[model samples]
Target chain A: MDIFRRNNVTVAGNPQGPTVVLAHGFGCDQNMWRLTVPALADAYRLVLFDYVGCGRSDLTAFSEERYASLEGYARDVVEVCEALDLRDATFVGHSVSSMVGVLAAETAPERIGSLVMVAPSPRYVDDEGYHGGFSAQDIDELLASLDSNYLGWSAAMAPVIMGHPDRPELGEELKNSFCATDPDMARVFARTTFLSDTRDDLGRVKVPTLVLECVQDVIAPREVGAFVHQAIPGSSLVTLDTTGHCPHLSAPEATNEAIRDFLAGLPR
Target chain B: MIHTDQQPEPYESQNEGAPDIQSHRDSTPDAAFAALLEDSAEELYEAAPCGYLSTLMDGTIAKINATLLDWLGLERDAVLGRMRFADLLTVGGKLYHETHFAPLLRMQGDISGIAMELRCANGDRMPVLVSSVVKYGESGEPLLIRTTLFDARDRRAYEEELLRGRKAAEEARRQAEADRARLQDALTVLQKSLLPDTLPTIPGVETAAHYHIASPDRLGGDFYDVFPLDGERFAFFLGDVCGKGPQAAAVTSLTRYTLRAAALHDADPASALATLNTVLHDRYTGSGDPRYCTAIFGILTPGASPGRLTIQLASGGHPPAVVLRADGTAAFLPTPGGLLVGVLPDAHFATAETVLTPGDTLLLYTDGLTEARTGADRTSLYGDEALLAFAADHAGKSTVDVIGALTDLLASFGDGLDDDTALLALGVPPLTAQP
Candidate 1:
């Protein structure tokens, strides 16, 4: 019941530059965008809000049966955008957040401008015709891990998301906004987002798209980024020469350069 | 294999055969041996197979073992002197322990073997069955509470299986209820589809019919319909199909439609039954599962002048119909013999003719009313004699009065009557009023 307890926490960037909505992955919060936000703050109006039951959002607003679906998170993106009156804003999504943006854009077509898909994956399960990585049984094993050892799975999953935990700052940054989520909600979302098959909706994105791939990312690899590109017609793909899934945190300068170049090429 | 901490004999007893060992060893070897014993105690605590720890009187963790530390991926500096016992539980575990576990332990002196969870340093939670005992020093002073924990992976899987089984059972129950409702709706639709919503009013006839559905939860097997074939002639039928539920309901639908269609082709009631018998026998021939039913059909021919009806009655393996005489006398019209519908390819239905004068009434009823078994001698069914007796007492009454009596009689049976009942009554009302 206490999970629905939430307060507004938004970080606004620049008005002169383009607006960018930053969405963090499953574990971390709005703070995970620290490196990327600094570089784009002057050039883009950055708006960030926590998914309810994660980060600073209300915990009581979370329901196991309702929040158990990624449809809630996708709806949250739409509501937050409408609540803030964000129009034609660029969507910067990481990991599963990239698919959330796609759904948000599909829900309200006019609210989106261009999508900067960073390490996006439509599904974590492999099917007969599609290879989204991992199998349905493999995902079951991951769910078992959470049910058996929630903390162990959460901590184990952190390094896999952050890539290299030996760098204390990156590890510590992820640790800051983690416990802010209801573990039950996280478990449901983990199963849903990673297990979903959204191959049908990729053709519906009306806006321009840019797929960003990490050259050495173990979680969302270059092959996945290429797959996303193949699904979306006329979409451009760029593989960054970074080693982690979270390149903005590890190699910000190169990441910033790629994003800035893509934004400059837009039809002003 | 490692006996590093075995207790030794007393120093004075050992020194009896040796030098003044107490003086020589008191400063060096004895002190070293004491330190070795202490170190061994620490090693045993750290390397125990099951997790063991000591909590302060206030519940702060004073010491923990390496077995648990390794499970949590936590070094000693992180937990040994820092976090409290409650800090190791997940958010839900913490809430449960505070609301349930802590109160129980405080009142009970010790609570043992309770299933709980410990959140590891790496954010993974370990399910464990925990036991705790509080130690008191001399003079009844509370010292420290020692706790032990065992892994519960296999137990968690078993619990999940039970939860799934319960969930599946509940879903199955809900589905069965839904299926029952769906069958009832289909029966109602089929029943209405066959019968006329309103009965036809002949020139001199006050017709009233009632269909009592004993059970709306399952499909009823009774049916009745009244239709005008043409000019001054009208046709009416009331029947009961054997059995109940979806299968019987299906046959009822087919039988009702066949009777209507065949009557349109020929006014001969025998020909109509012949058509229905062929349809049912042919459709269900190969399968040894045969369906049968009882029915009474009548064609009412109005008088050429007025105020009368020449009614032709045809009954199939059904009960004898009652005709209350116009002059306050009730009697049964002779319908010789008829075969049950669908028993033979050429089933015969006997025909009879009766003239309904001004106040004569014709009553048609299924076996549910006459065959209702009740009383201390439940072996006796409500036969035709009882129905005729009941009708004789209510003679000269309007059709509604007789129908109301029959309806009350149906309600009186309660659970004794199992089959569906349908009754149709046509009485010529004194030729004064018209509906």
Candidate 2:
């Protein structure tokens, strides 16, 4: 199989500079990095891709049994790295992808050298002593909400979502195509994202890690951010003063500056 | 009543133009009513039927209409400048708004017809459809956001009903497929029971048999068996019952057991077939659904001389058996005068006898082989002449080789071979020199 085409991998930016792979989280595809790409393109070699079952990636390659856990997504990441023969590259993941990057790093230690977790959370449901800011019932309600919005992702809404006749410069492939996904695949992805627990894997991070959290993210609260920081002994944490879960889109300037500084500090 | 009250006014003012009546009404109660009909734009904004709101780029509500405030049961003071649009949604709706709704709106200038639920003041959920647009400033920068909400209670309930109906239909289709698979499995097990798992090894002879079924869904009526009749003799039979399905299968099962029992009582081939004929005619002749079958029964007895065997066989409305000689020649042992068994009280069974020298074989089969269709148009039958020629081609070969070649010939017919076929071959092994 052509791994690059299967994952819809895209390579951009300075070819001679260090590589940085941008991995988007659930509910969106590689387009989530649209705003952040421009800020880092001048100094880094950027790799962006949509996981299987998301964006324009091949839907036929998606297997429910394989993707039911986080390992399947990590395998996609590792394969992309091997396809390009990347070495010592930095992996930047958002939301649930932060844990996926950690797993990829563990599987192929040579391909990914450092990590940058954006709005990261190892767990979303609350435990007895730890507060991840959600109850088990809340995740179920989220799945229900995904079911209710099935019409938005259906073919009836495709023409409206893909129609951008006024913006002819956006090209045929990129015209207004933003978070359109198959409803059934999205349901599987949603279940995998909200139900997974990767808190135990945080202690094994052996690379240079940067944990970027938003100031008022309801999905990943400040307490969860602190737990992630303390779990990784030498990891650094930076909190962006934003209101939503996506700091890169909400506060792009601060998010870019933090990422650039972390990359510069890494060993050559 | 109003028409009757004003009926005489137009006629009384015919001398004047229509404008004179309009001017005269300026001084009457009609003028006051017209004044009341015209309202300012402010009243329309506050009293529209649907909910409306405008927010900043970051979702801070800057303005809200009275209709939306009434739906939320909140005062204007409590909402404006104090809440974002995400605050009014339930937890699921809030997550949806943050993940899918917000990203989509930012990418496209506007988004419409999104279904969601809002939390009212008393904790009741209200289903609504929302549409939003981003207003751009003079510098092409995004400014405030404008939104409208429509109550979708009735529509949501109907959609739920459709989803339920679709689920039920899918479940029923799955159940039907499972039932068909289970029934096919049962039919396969029952079909296996009608034949021997393996033929017994005769002391001084070699035997090979093959049975072919045209369709797995329907049980075929073809059957064959080879078993010992006594210490010095072996009995074999091959047949096809008339028609197909359960009734034919019942007849096939009965015929096999009756022939076996009669052959044990008397090793003569003709007597064994006559007893089977009597049993079948007595059991089925008087019934309205009379049944019958075509069969060839035979016995093999070792001759007094070494490297030789005696064969005695009888046929009841069955095709002739072929004999292949050691000198590479083949001929049919015809039994032409036989009547179909179970058709009459006293049926005439034709009898034939032959000697099998070393390297000689006897082949018996059902009509499914000779009646198979051939040619490009599939209109020609593979008759006795072609089978005799085929046997001639494989003369002097062992029983296994001859049977294997015939099995290949049957397979070559493909869809043209529609009926069940059974083949049984018995041969005396070729003599080998002493070491």
The most accurate candidate by lDDT is 2
Chain B TM-score, model 1, reads 0.74
Candidate 2 clashes between residue pairs 3 or more apart in a chain or in different chains: none
TM-score of each: 0.52, 0.79
Candidate 1 lDDT over residue span B1-435, tens digit each:
001221232222333533443445556756867555444444556676778777775556877788988877778788876876667765445433432344334334465555667788777878777776666655545466677787776776676686567658869999998997887777778767756788877667778887777777677788888888898788888888889878888888898888889889987777777787788888776777789888888888888767688888788888878998767789988777888888887777888889887778899989888888877666678888989999998777778888998888888877767667888988777654444
Model 2, span B274-328: residue lDDT tens:
8888988888887888999888999889999876899999999899999998788
Q: Cα miss at A237, model 1 (Å)?
A: 55
Candidate 1's DockQ is 0.02
What lDDT does the true structure give each of the candidates?
Answer: 0.72, 0.84
RMSD in Å for model 2: 9.1
True contacts kept of each: 0.00, 0.52
Model 2 lDDT tens row, A191-225: 89888899999999999999999888777889889
